[model samples]
Target: MAKTLKSWLQILLKLVNSTIGIVGISMIIYSMWMARVWQRHMEGSSDDFFSFSVIWFILTFLGIGITLCAISSFGHIAAHTANTHCLSCYMVAIFLLLLVETTLMADIILNSDWEEDFPEDPTGRFDDFKDFVKSNFNTCQWIGLFMFLAQGCSIVSATFLRTLEKRQARYCESDEDDIAPSLPFLYHPVEPLPCTVADLPGAPSSLYWC
Candidate 1:
């Protein structure tokens, strides 16, 4: 039988969900490394140019990434098992990530100047905004963009993918009914015996049982 739309969507969402987890975990690791580097540099620096709060912020962001990984794991489980409750939790996590990513993207687009932030060289050759992002944006920003897209797609697909618990229960019942062994009739009608020559008359007296 052909697969249902929900099954296809579940597959797609599971792939995206796994990608998000991997990317999120990588980002967390990168952030932690950066934080450690900054800490080591700050220890010997005479000038307080960079605050320790940056490390805290990085750690906080890493925490968010860890949370994303957890949510993605749950989503995978939900997709595999068709668990409605787990799917709901996964949706909630995707929505929250969507909110955060959207907010960050908006902040970057609204407050930051692409041209000024990435000024031209001495030859006055400047990269376009697209190229500027490719050359200048940090790993977190890039990963966040990817995460945003993945989560958005996942959320949309999940709406169609999440199976209804009641419907699933009914489907299970139907499958059991199909597989269950049916009992044959226990009370078959008794067939009447044929009349023989011996049963017809007194000749049957010796042959017939009392």
Candidate 2:
């Protein structure tokens, strides 16, 4: 039963790691595309829809690559017997990576030309193009800042977990090595005591005969 449980757990971890990795990769690709679109739009080119897509693509790819590595490391930790500290490291790394991606998304969504109310132009000379660029820049900047903050939080959490695990391990070891005295009641035997009826104040006469 224990073995079965362990196997199931291993499978579950693998699935989770793989799913996250795939998602991370996809997000990076999408971010890159968005950046390109932004860049194209800014250059008055109809081929691109956004002017900041290049920057977005670069940042996203870097963040995603780190995230993927972290996830892979987590899978290794989950599948094998490793120090809890190592697992904690993997968790922190993955968290930071995800945080970056989230921040980028938030920035793009917030800064995009969603509010420009400008008509789309095939020739890139639309009056709304300037507004669109300004909006996108603001959104991207905010998103980058948010991503940094999220990564910081992830690092902090991971550090806390790591410290806790280390402390727990130390406590366990101390208990094993320390020869503390046990309580007397805990050491007492369960057998009944041998006693005479005469020793009891409430003993009956028939008990004394026995």
Q: lDDT per residue, candidate 1, 1-210, as tens digits? A: 224756777789889888888976886886677566556766766745244343444555578778878888888898887677777888887888777767766776797664464333321112232475577669647765776788888887676666444466788899888766543444556687765434556564545432
RMSD (CA, angstroms), candidate 2: 14.0
Compare the candidates by TM-score and give the number of the best one: 1
Model 2 TM: 0.37
Which regions of candidate 2 fall more than 4 Å away from where they truly are? 1-11, 23-70, 114-175, 178-210
Give the clashing pairs for model 1.
none
Residue 199 local lDDT, model 2: 50
RMSD of each: 8.5, 14.0
How far residue 112's Cα lies from its native spot in candidate 1, in Å, is 7.5
Candidate 2 per-residue lDDT over residues 1-210, each given as its tens digit = 544554554555455555555655665675466556556556754454433332433453557656665566665564454356665666666676666667756675787755344334443323343466577988856754754553454344344445555676887889966645565557878886675555556766536422
Clashes of each: 0, 13
The lDDT, on a scale of 0 to 1, for candidate 1 is: 0.68
What lDDT is reached at residue 135 by model 1? 75
